[model samples]
Target: MLSIVPRHYFLGFIPLAAGAELITVFGVVNKASGIYGLLSIFTGHPITAAQLVLNIISLILLPVFLYALHSVRRQQALPVVAFSYVYFLDMLANLAFTIYFSVTWFRVFDATATAEAGKGTASSLDTASERGLSITIIVLALLFKVYFCFVLFGYARMLVRKAGLRSDNGEGKYMKQLQFIMLAIAPSFWRRGGRRAGKGRMVNTLEEGIEMY
Candidate 1:
């Protein structure tokens, strides 16, 4: 399996992958809001109870995202590895939830389309196009998630490698397991582009001279 080490997170600048981590924090906020909505739904009826539980589990795992972000800011190696693992797992859980919700949404939409068509207010062609658009958006979002996971795991690998950590050490072995799992789950398309980040270039340019005393 090929290892993915991105050259830069966005564009040709932004040395570290922390930008993605920050974006991930916002994503977690969105997920938490979504979970709240799902919980509300569960209150009215027992529907989607399983999704509620899965989302709660995912939310419970999110504190590490914050912890890891802080550690990455401090340039700590081990905690970054843990952050990478939490991110990978969170991506998987979210993928499952996204798929389930998309399917359920389409089912409900189809039923609604049937009702509207019976009243001659909805055109079948218009409904089909709308459904197609929704599918395209979902696919694009999932692809982005896969690529984001690649960026995160690569960033962690870069830190571990730079810190002179031995692969036989506990953290190293755990990271290797994560890499293996990502390689198994990620599609081939996720491997293309963004590997140009040079070695030792991860430190932000703005913070370059602050450590000297």
Candidate 2:
């Protein structure tokens, strides 16, 4: 029987786990610095209340993202749905970060001209520091992103090559699409696997081919 969830979904968990770790670190930093208030400034008159909403949203998204990933690993069609959920959560977090930074910069500008600018100036400096930390976390997240794509590419390649082997054909649409996506990332993977060699020979499994290359 065919597995309902692809093996690649399990492979994806590694990167997802890493991304979660980065987000957790980000959340801790936000809590430590009380920059959450800046988020509230955008939403309403009382900044603390607004920050509370933002924190709630972040708290909600983190768990939802993890749950989605878990569902994908366990259920049929769940991977697709889970991927969508995780994607949306990731986008929301990014949007929140952007808003947070913009508010901080605006506060900095406001503070530059006022007698009471000292507090705003300090807050702005802290915001900048926070943004720097977020950037570092984002870089770490990107590392996971690369790994996720690599695993996906490996699985898709396996499917394509398997189809070609059965047909004794030069190439198939699935194989072509896989090659295209892989090429978009690492051209080396495409060049090595998609290159024309002896016809009708079964391509090794994705893992074996990857090892050989």
Candidate 3:
């Protein structure tokens, strides 16, 4: 049976993620002036440099993402698990850098002062509605990424266990910790507790089990 959800659609963000980073890398490189631009040499940010490296790393992983999407779409455990693992780690690093960027941007008073001054005293910097909308969008994006990562982890676990790949009957330490992190981020992961009843029994974050056939 065909899966109801376009599980492959989750992978659609791959290019956007890569493109955004590529843009940022050049922004930091050329020292362009704007929100897209990173810090200037006079007031450099270590995190901006870190973001450049990670963005390059992400670009290099584009093939891994493609393989993951293909594997997941075909229900192939080997490549799905392999690339999913890599992508999840990449995503964790990405999230950390995102937080770092937000913090660093907040502290960049020179740019903030310049931007505020350009407003010509007509409006305050605090625009509550604009700030609220931005925060909502960011929070939603983060939540979706976390949930999808968890789904990948769970699907891989189900496959490995079903195939009887491990005699020890345990998930790996890294995957376990990653799943735990996801669970902590999303409390609605109640269905995973019932996996003993069946294999591929999804407790949906998106599917609430939507990815399963």
Candidate 4:
């Protein structure tokens, strides 16, 4: 398993595991609220398929998130590992939805921009700036999610190793694949290199394990 930081730094992975669950719960709530807001404002219109899917997912996972949060707080091994896998898969799903929505938004924006350009109401420079800002936000969000995945999986691995769980015995090959995907998806991660353990220097920080993965 890839180590995001020294083993001792995680304090048995309790804090990170609990924090991950809490963050996910909040995220699900936020998504639910956004969906509700859209529905409220567009009461006469049928909701899009994307919104329906997101609503169902958020509804289904909210209870699961709560259960996982409870279990992780008790330091349960299975739930921690399971939640890590769920979070990783959710990250991929979020990526797919993000791409779909981004493409859809750009298409609609392009049409509006064209119309506004003809009307002399909006400039191409303003459109480009908006696009750039949206893309930047999306990229940053994905990068942060990628790093959080590492932290979560690292914590899960620690828990499994501690509990002597053989359920993850064949995970090494899959983990290599995951690492490859991470590197390919976020090449800019390579530029964030920081301190490393070498020359008798003790490594105990998250930055120290950036290259270790």
Among these predicted structures, which one has the highest lDDT? 1
lDDT of 3 by residue, 126-145 (tens): 54454566668877877766
Candidate 1, 1-213: lDDT as tens digits: 344446456323665566656656765576566467566774785556766677677567566666766777777766776676677777897888888899899999999999999999999999999999999999999887777776666666566566744333334566766544543443232233323332233455435766663
**Model 1 spans > 4 angstroms off:** 1-5, 34-47, 169-213
Error of 2 at 91 (Å): 0.9
Please give me the total number of clashing residue pairs in predicted model 1.
2
C-alpha TM-score for every candidate: 0.69, 0.32, 0.50, 0.66
lDDT value, candidate 3, whole model: 0.50
lDDT by candidate, in order shown: 0.66, 0.46, 0.50, 0.64
**Ten contiguous residues with the weakest lDDT in model 2:** 1-10
* 2 or 3, greater by lDDT: 3
Better of 1 and 3 by lDDT: 1
Q: What is the lDDT, from 0 to 100, of the residue 128 in candidate 2?
A: 60
Score candidate 4 by TM-score against the native. Answer: 0.66
What C-alpha lDDT does candidate 4 achieve relative to the native structure?
0.64
Task: Show pairs that collide, candidate 2.
Answer: none
